[model samples]
Target chain A: MVEKDVIVNSDAGIHARPAMMIVREAMKYPCEVMLIKDSVEADAKSIMSVLGLAIISGSKLTIRAHGEGETELVDFLINLIEKDFRV
Target chain B: MRKLTVRYFIEGEGRIDLQLRLYAGEGGLDKEIKYGEINRPGLALAGFFDYFAYDRIQIFGQGETAFMNQLSYEQKMKTYSDFFSYDLLCCIFTHDYVPDKLFLEFAEKKNVPIFLSKRGTTRFITLFVHVIDEIFAEQVTLHATLVDVFGVGVLLTGKSGVGKSETALELIERGHRLVADDMVIVKKIDESLLMGAGSEILKHHIEIRGIGIVNVREIFGIRSVRNRKRIEMVILLEEWDSAKEYDRLGLDDKKYSILDIEVPYITVPVRPGRNIPVIIETAALNQRLKKIGINSARELDEKIKKWIMTEGQK
Candidate 1:
């Protein structure tokens, strides 16, 4: 298992657009990816789960992944949030 | 686990029929309720503080009220001063019995909330306990679909894009009710029953690979969807692996544990030409039969053993 915590610096937090981007990026990996906030785990591949977290600016999120290529998947998600979900 | 505060309880009073009116101590509305069981504080009021469960929501019925009414001003002051010394959750007076002026004064001074309910002592306790139990219930969010088939709640679980939604859609078309799709919030109620429901934003909506999000209630009418259901079985839909051996005889029972409760479980391999929905309906019916003491597999085995013995005797 691989896990990394990142702070969401986006001004708008994880609204619909940024939530979709996170889901889309997580879908590219075959392993299971999860986003956790306040001890509640949400499936990263599911758009509704990602949005349900209601993540806001400066919120701490933990990206956890298990199975093949788990470390790369976690790093990729952390990078996505750090980059303000540009792509 | 989620924390339950007095404010949440007050906000949810309408839904649970608590019929509570905040009488005093608005500042203490944020006090946490740690236990589900309520306390009467009758002994504590009489200057006996042994085994006093001050953390629980204290209930002041007629007996406690009468006792308080009989206390003299000096006695009331002494007793209440001792009572409010401990960190308490809140106090509720049933039967519309209002506390004395001194009691409310002490409550306000100590930042302890007091509420009044018109319901009788017994009725109010029943309702209060019911709500508190649910608030403290164990809960988890699962990435799956929940459907009610043949009066049985079946939880369909699997990885993403494993046809859980497709199978649930087909089940809905066949007259089954869809409780939730994609993200199912399951709560273990009363330490036995597992109730599954959807999140507020995602309830009654399903996401298909090509069709986007479809509102099941609007598309299939109200009868085709339910707000929540008790999860009695769990079925995991996985890709068909040639090397893996599946359960064929159905002799051994498989269980899936959620929140420490064991539920019947089955793994169904997904492949083309297999009617997964119909199979789920049958499994639900079979589970109902087993619940009624009619084990088809065991009964059949018993009959075969008796026949084989008769043949050997002949």
Candidate 2:
């Protein structure tokens, strides 16, 4: 498994639509992905789970993934979070 | 799960068939009932069709029937014609009220099915709405174990051998009820509510790692099993990793979506010496507290913030 810590920078933080985008991106890779905020962890591939974190701007998130292409998956997720979920 | 039509309604079992019989427009029995709600077309009969929900099953109760009875032959024809002009699934006359001749003529002419029921108007409407709700509810089957812990429907999900069944069994032994084991079939009965049940073959049967298939009802008694339950929360179990930091404060809320509806979600790490069942019980209780508008973590956070503010003032 691979893990990375990144700060949320989106102006509106991570809401429904942005969380859905993360789920969509996470589904592209054949890996089990999870998002950790403080002690709460959520399935990165689940839109509802991602939104459950109630992540706001400046919130620190730890992304973890296992299986094939986990490294690329984690990097892609970190980049997405760092980029503020730009189109 | 599937569309219900007038034909299915007439042939369906239960009290619906007790007094219900097709009166007119047999050709329209296959017409689908698009909406779950039934409508009483009181204003529509008076030439008001602005908000007429034509897709609903029209109910002709005492008031409607009395109004129809008071109408002249010409007025009745006009009203019935206008009412049946829209594409309606069917019309039901309760209290065994027979349809007027002109009403039947308009119904047959418009190809709208009409049914007669011996049940009173209110009772019939309630029963029909419930039956239609069941037939048209959205359903999805999930690979998980569902248990009612402290009156909360807790769905346990994870990999095949993540101890979902084992944890559910433990919960059952503690006097909780098991809704489903292995596969949970969830149905969205309302806008935001989901009801879950087990398949016929797997109902009340739970598979432990090495214990084979155990009948929860037999071992734990009837009170330990439920036919169906409304899913309120989801708990995902995963193997514990020392390097991964788990949520300790639980200030961050989480959710899991099933069938387009969001429900509370939590992930519990599995490891030796960890009392998973006890943790789950507390989770269920905590969920109940949240439902009642009491959030302990948020309350504590507010308290700490207040203390910090007072110390800074001093």
Candidate 3:
């Protein structure tokens, strides 16, 4: 599994807009996307799972994936966050 | 401390076809050279003969003299066995001729995947190696978007056309950096730290309303486009809804999770002329303030309640 952790820089956390965007992106790939924080794991595409996180700014989160060119996809997301959610 | 050994990481699914036990001895490819960068013909041929003496050798390559040579064949079937290797995997064959029957027989004996690609180059193969490195490295990525607002990493995400680019562009104009554009890549270096960057195709390119695509590096120079950053915040853009109850006070927290990490987020509704860029900027700045343990929204709410109580007493 390829994984990267990023702090939730936005004040809103993974709410409607961000959640939808992430879910939309996650659905495009033929792999498993998991959002993990602390010891809890959630599916990247689910609205309820995202909302359940209650992530605040500075809260660290991990995105893990497997299968079908997952390395590239995982890298793409990691860069996005490393750039501080700029993309 | 013998750290040098062949290590195989099995992924997907597969089984060893034949019960093949490899051996190294005097007669075969073993007597050639010590296991290392066997680029020298002496070393390679040494390895070749040593292995070949045991069974047939399947040397894969492009046609580079240093690797595989078939042009030497028409005259005589050189002292070698079969040769094969994909263009994308390995190349540089010495000749263009096919291997002899002995070599073919060995390949048939050992069912190896013989693939050939006419396209791609050495650089492409290098990329394949890089990816394999990442896999072996076991690096993980988080689903996220990173934009710079006042030098702060603010990951913007939302449905298509929710104004992420517009806000990022606006923030850029306000003297903030643009980390990644549409997508972001996050890699975990350790248990606590995270690194991020932009995709090769979309790096430094942000699309605006009238402008189709503008290169941030070309226009704003390199400083505006960062290679990576530790994601500090996530700002989500959403369409303004009259029925929806938005976060009036910034006390309520939201988070976008990735790669087993929890990233904080802020939801900003888009409607009319509310300055989203400014709000995002303030959000980032506010996050910075919160880092120091100063909650502006909470403090303001507290002041308002105090004032209301005092006014009632008056």
Candidate 4:
């Protein structure tokens, strides 16, 4: 498994639209994806789960991926979160 | 879903047999009832059809029938013709009142179905509206598991094989009620409220990865399952990743918009040794506390800020 911690840079945090974007990306890879916030964790591949974390502009999040394309999945999520999931 | 026809309201599956008998305009039984609301067309009957909502089913109570009886035959014909000029879905006369000749003639001429109910206006309205609401409410299917935790509706959502059903099973074992599993039909009952229910075939049935399908109501008894619930919050379970920085303070009052209404939301990572069911339970209770204006994190932040002020003064 591969993991990386990134800070959310979006002003609105991971709201519905951004959460859906992340889930869309997460589903592209065939790896198991998860996100952690403090003691809580969520499925990165589920829009509802991603929004559940309520990751705000300054909030930090850990993205983890397992199975085949774990490294690529982790890198993509980190970049996505850092870029505020633009569009 | 689209609006239901008048005939379907009486003969459809889950139909409410309110003993509604047709008095006139039987040919208009196929007319569609768009809104679930009933209207008393007193104004329209009094020759004021300016704001007449033709889409609604008119209710002619005793007051309306008596008023019609007081009018002369020619006057009543004019009133009925003018009223029926607008395309109404139907007209229902309460208290089993028979339609007058002019009313029946106008109903037949205008192709507006007329129904008679034995129940009073208030009782029949209540029952008819209740049935109509069920048929006409806006609905959308969601891939999620819904459970009731401490009377708060908690919807568990995640990708395939993300342990959503497993977490729901644990919650069910802990004395919570399971509203739906796998496929939840979320209905927008009002502007700010959403209600969720399972498909009839999948009601109370949860599918675990290896265990196949398990019936929650059968295993956990009737108290463990409910037909539907008002969704209050959503908890998403995901695999654990060491590199992501999860929300530690929870100061962000996050919301998930479903059917335009925002609901409280949380994400719990799924990993070995993490008790997700307990976290969901606590999350539900915390939501309740927030509803009552008890925010622990905000209160603590204020307390810390006050402490710092006193320390600096010293």
Q: What is the TM-score of each candidate against the true structure?
A: 0.93, 0.67, 0.45, 0.73
Please estimate how well model 1 matches the true structure, expressed as its whole-model Cα lDDT.
0.88
Tens-digit per-residue lDDT, A1-87, candidate 4: 898888888899887677767877887888888888764556676544555456788888888899888898888778877777763
**Candidate with better TM-score, 2 vs 3:** 2
Off by over 4 Å in 4: A1-87, B16-24, B105-111, B118-134, B311-313
TM-score of 1: 0.93
Each prediction's Cα lDDT score?
0.88, 0.83, 0.56, 0.81
TM-score for predicted model 4 compared with the true structure: 0.73
Residue A82, candidate 3: C-alpha displacement in angstroms: 36
DockQ of each: 0.57, 0.02, 0.03, 0.03
Query: Which order, best to worst by TM-score?
Result: 1, 4, 2, 3
Best by DockQ: 1
Candidate 1 C-alpha lDDT tens digits along A7-67: 9999999987888778877888888999999877888988767777779999999999998
Query: What does the TM-score come to for chain B in model 3?
Result: 0.53
lDDT string for model 2 (B1-314, tens) is 34457787568533234358888999898787667788899899888999998898888899989988899988987887778778887888899899788888878887898888989988987777776686578777676789999999999998655688889888998899999876677888888989998766557877665565577899889999999999999999999988989989989889899999999999999997899999999999999999999999999999999998998679
Clashing pairs in 1: none
Q: In terms of lDDT, which candidate is stronger, 2 or 3?
A: 2
Error of 4 at B186 (Å): 1.1
TM-score of 2: 0.67
Between candidates 1 and 3, the one scoring higher on TM-score is: 1
